[model samples]
Target: MKTSRYILITLLMIGCISSCSDDFIEVANKETLTDSSFWQTEDHALQALTATYGALHGADGSKWTFFEEIYVAMAYRADDQINNTAETYGRNLASFSNTTEDSGPNNIWKTSYAGISRANQILEKVPNIEALSQETKDVIVAEAKFLRAYYYFWLVTGFENVPLVTTFEVELQNLFPEQSESSVIWSQIEKDLTEAEANLLTEHAAEWKGRATKGAAKALLGKVYLFQEKWPQAEVKFSEVVAMDYALLDNYADNFNGNSENGPESIFEVQFSGDRSNGNDERQVFNFEISPYAFGGWELFFPSKWLVDEMKTDVDANGDPSERVYESIFFDDPKSDMYSMEATAKIPYSDVAENLNNPNYFKKYSFNTDEEFYNGTNITLIRFADVLLMYAEALNENGKTPEAIIEVNKVRERGNAVPLTTMTQTELRNQIRHHERPVELAMEFGIRWFDLYRWQRGSTATESIKSTLEAHNKPFSENFQDKHIIFPIPLQEININDKLQQNPGW
Candidate 1:
């Protein structure tokens, strides 16, 4: 999240409190803080807390590591997307051929741990700040805890069996801690989120818009439960989120625009801004990384033909093509309702027949080439649409198909798609697994991969995963395995910590 330029300056001024340092004890100047001299003022605590918030950014350097891990490792592997012929990263992920030494996983592992280290520093120092009120201390500590849990969530889910380090004071040997059981890691996640829910405000004021909120904590906690098959607990947490003032925007695309960030629909988001007058670079390069070469960008990732065909069948409440389908995709076809902004105006993409290979680009992050340079689109982590779908899944599992359809239709109606009034329990379950989530939340992040993982956890594993893959020609017969569900622990981490073991079938 981009704070005011002053806060960003505060983050840079407070140097040497960083993950790159091994000494962690030697920075001695006023700008370089130490344990004995720092944490005495409210400003000190605030600036340190701001640094903890900085850990949430997924992009570091120019690589966009956060997107690389979630999008490449998970989303690209799923059936909904495919890499363009020129992009190796997406193709490798889709084919299950990415290695442990792959930079995507390695970067996520390093950056996430770096965030945890910063957060631990805050938790260690914030409690001792007598200058700040108890309320202020609680909120700061809660935010740090949430950040720790957030980082760990990416770790355990993406890498599983991660080092459960929770403190700053560690012996040299203790630095190479062994991997903890997935269960143990999950317990720590729940612990931090529970405390976060208790302390974070229901809503942050406009100036503090992107800070974690009660809804964010509850929603994340519920997702954790859903991952673990604790359905009743998931239902309760999602119900609380649904009860909040959050609502879907009138237009589904509003959620992706920079001018309309922190809307009622966004429960949690990574705030990005293109304004570089500030010393910090908070711009998200998602579009730059994935846009067609024609847009002066890398043609890295695009929707599969299977996905494009799925959109053609989808219809709105008005019995016309779905607004979401049109809003979500752009390809070289006049019959299909998409246009290429990079192409000449008033010219059908079909006119460019020689270049057509069903070239589909994600229109969700589309922006004007003339107006602004860098993309400022906020990446939404949780939205009301997800809460509705998760709640509907819980209802369907509990044999409340009637109630489930009502919730599912809320998302459909927002996309201007017709709502289903009737469906058997089996159909409701299929609706969630196949239709609703893929159409509404495609290419967002790990949501699709997580859906596939959890679908296999059910009794209908055969019917759920393999069938979908086969029907869509998604290379289930190519290289995916039962053990391929989770990624291998990065080889570099294994080298550093001999106590760590790789996941099965790397």
Candidate 2:
């Protein structure tokens, strides 16, 4: 089992503070922690780092970082997802009509910074612990660097330019730091990941399975280079990761069905648990958000018709519908089953009157057998198939289209989809951008949205965004502007810090 030591320590610390007497004057009370008392032991360092990881879910328990608003902000803007609910912030984001004051962006900003703050605290204090072995301290520091880079990646990608706060001490001295250039932020992320790759273990023990690994750092660094169009550099990094002991699971659905979490395919995943005892309530709510209403889900959003149409275009080697299509969506397929029900008990999604006219509900993360809304399924951030596809993309851009097809075939082989034949770099690029990636990685993370931003035509990033949205006949196509490429800095943040500036058209 993944360790719950971190969560238990947090609860114990909270209990310590709560139990302190109101009658007594507070002056370095031993029961209640101060900086002098804490940060003195290796256990303290572990506790602090654990809290940093916990921030991936939420700083406070109320707003789950990835499962709630952040997921909406990331996925809803893309052409693949349709927001069917009446939530104003969600609707505004989906339509590109969101402003600086939208709660989606604001909560994401807060959660990411909260994680960075905890990471910075560890970097500041973990080195000073007298009892920690140098080897252990180095690993802890490396992990902190990885986490800092992870949070900053989100900030830079979502908001373009953001404050690059590294040191807790420096942040305390100047709380209202000016935003760094996006290039500068990317450089820092590269530096952190480079160092992390050098120091992180190639694999962690079962107890530490969810922590960042060398493979995770290299994969993320590869992604950073890919975004910058550093094709050769990206290829090298992904090549190194592909050489690691990671492979696509035999069954694609096992990646999300909670049966194979922290399994061989996972490079990094945000840890969660269904057991709410010991202050561990980090389970995700994707099942509730994405499953069909007939299956007891809220039906907040459904797959766009464009995505369903795209997935259906590909066939397996047997000339049947692609297994990926059956695995990815609860469609009108007679072969597909819901809630992992038995074949005899299966119900076609089209049979339900409520879902008859709807496009399709996501089947990727909805692999539960019960009515429980929250689940312990870890949200995979990076996996081996993604690495293979990314490696293929980099190789294609680097003028190795034939070799790139090999990697793409590896992913397609696992999905039981037909492999591509030899093609030109431009042809292969279009394939990877349009067909390979969307079908393989839809409704997971922000892959589609991020791909739209990075896949440029002439000069502006919006060329790809505008063309893709228009091609899909998205309602937001008319509303999308060049400035919508990056979100506005939250108005709440700008209000608190006068030095902060919003993105141009906000």
Candidate 3:
């Protein structure tokens, strides 16, 4: 176990910032030490890894400074309520006309590289630590490789072909290169995850519960295959996860219950332990829920009205309310409490699609326990439910429609959807995309975007992007840009590195 002492050390080493301008590309090379002489011991190696993970947490958690939300938003237009930051990124994707001139894309590019540099620095040094056990060293290197692969995956997902940096040495030389092909980038990702699975322990050692495991590496590999539409390979990987011993929470809502941060269902989640007394602003998820009640801005990701209506019309055999449907959606109806009840009464959405906004905006993240409205809840990345759905998609794509439905209906049965004996490929696909996804993975940043990419439904992407802007009543051009499919390199990167070329049509 890397002692919590390292976490304290990282907090103490608050490097000074000379520039605070948003336009500045937070370069990694500037602050990074030029020589690896200081990184020699096993403790030193572990400290560096802690520093990388610590950076994953931002100043007060006010904004996910390290995690790039823009890339995920760009993947699907429909899944998010776009704001000033996301609009710039999505505009590029919707119209597909972004250049290096775009701001949001530039931020993503810079942050991702910063993380890559941190991971690479650890990889380059950890191998030389002779005191550490070979198993320990291998696991640390695998962890760094996993992080690097994650950064590369995000880069490819957003920009398609991007520069792939594997070592920290290159940064010391200020050597930047042109973008590589997506296939080449993915090959590196595959290599890293393959190595990670081989070296990483399958289960988290108690001290390492929140850290990545062999399962995470396998699941990520599965997702990578899914993105490439390699149905057979994807099916095999997802099946492996299904066969794992993980179990879903008895209640669908319990999986995301903030109190159960690392519940049995969570494969991996960004860990957030609330430290508000220390001035931590770790409450965005809470803020999202408290909007209507606290008289703060109602920024809840209201389920699309179309989705809620679909659920109301859907029925299961026992006829109890859909196990997946939450109470926030049902207040207005006569049989339900749409008009009268106060404390738990359903709140009305005021967007253009208010009636269409599914009242069932996920209550999973909605607070039921009496904690500060929005403190740190672990945001799940992969879970048992997701594995089930992916298994369904992979099977469907591979022409095993019956097996696919069986896999899908297992989840549906849990969520209280009537078990279907069969569904046409198109119907199964549509159901998963429209209802299952939004409800199952709502606001789990980027599920909507990824789903859109997989389906090749550009028109829905356009409408979804438009709806978010229009819902905010923001102005937009009538035409969508195809170049928006990928984000632009941050303008500062283009300015600093002469060889770094911009994406098309910025």
Top candidate, metric lDDT: 2
- CA shift at 33, candidate 1, in angstroms? 2.2
lDDT of 2 by residue, 1-506 (tens): 24354442332223234536788765556666666678889878988888888777655534354666787888888988888856453888888888888877887788888888888888888888999998889899999999999998988889978998887744344888899999999999999999988989888787778988899999999999998888899999999999889989999888887888988899998776766676556566777777666666767887888888888886898877687788888777666655622222446665664544365777887766344555678888888898899999899888899999999999988989988898988888888888888898888888888888877522322246877898997777799888888889999889998888889989
Task: Locate the minimum summed-lDDT window of 10 residues in model 2.
Answer: 8-17
Deviation from native of the Cα of residue 396 in model 1, angstroms: 1.2
Give stretches of model 3 more than 4 Å off. 1-37, 55-76, 79-103, 170-173, 279-286, 293-301, 318-321, 327-362, 368-371, 457-478
- On TM-score, the candidate that comes out on top is 2
lDDT ranking, high to low: 2, 1, 3
lDDT of 1 by residue, 1-506 (tens): 46332142122223344556675555456645455676789878777766666655543433255565545765777777776656666566677777777766777787788778778888888888889899989988888888899888988787778889899745577789888998899999999999989999888777778888889899899888877777788888998999889998998878775656888898888766665664556567666665555555566777777777777667865566687887777765454433234643323446654554437777677654233436567788888899899988887776678988999999988888888878888888877877788888888876887788777764542355555676888854367766667778889889888999889887
Cα deviation at 144, candidate 2, in Å, is 0.5
**Candidate 1 collision pairs:** none
Report the candidate with higher TM-score, 1 versus 3. Answer: 1
Say which prediction, candidate 2 or candidate 3, comes out ahead on lDDT: 2
Worst 10 residues of 3 by lDDT: 334-343
Candidates 2 and 3, the one with greater TM-score: 2
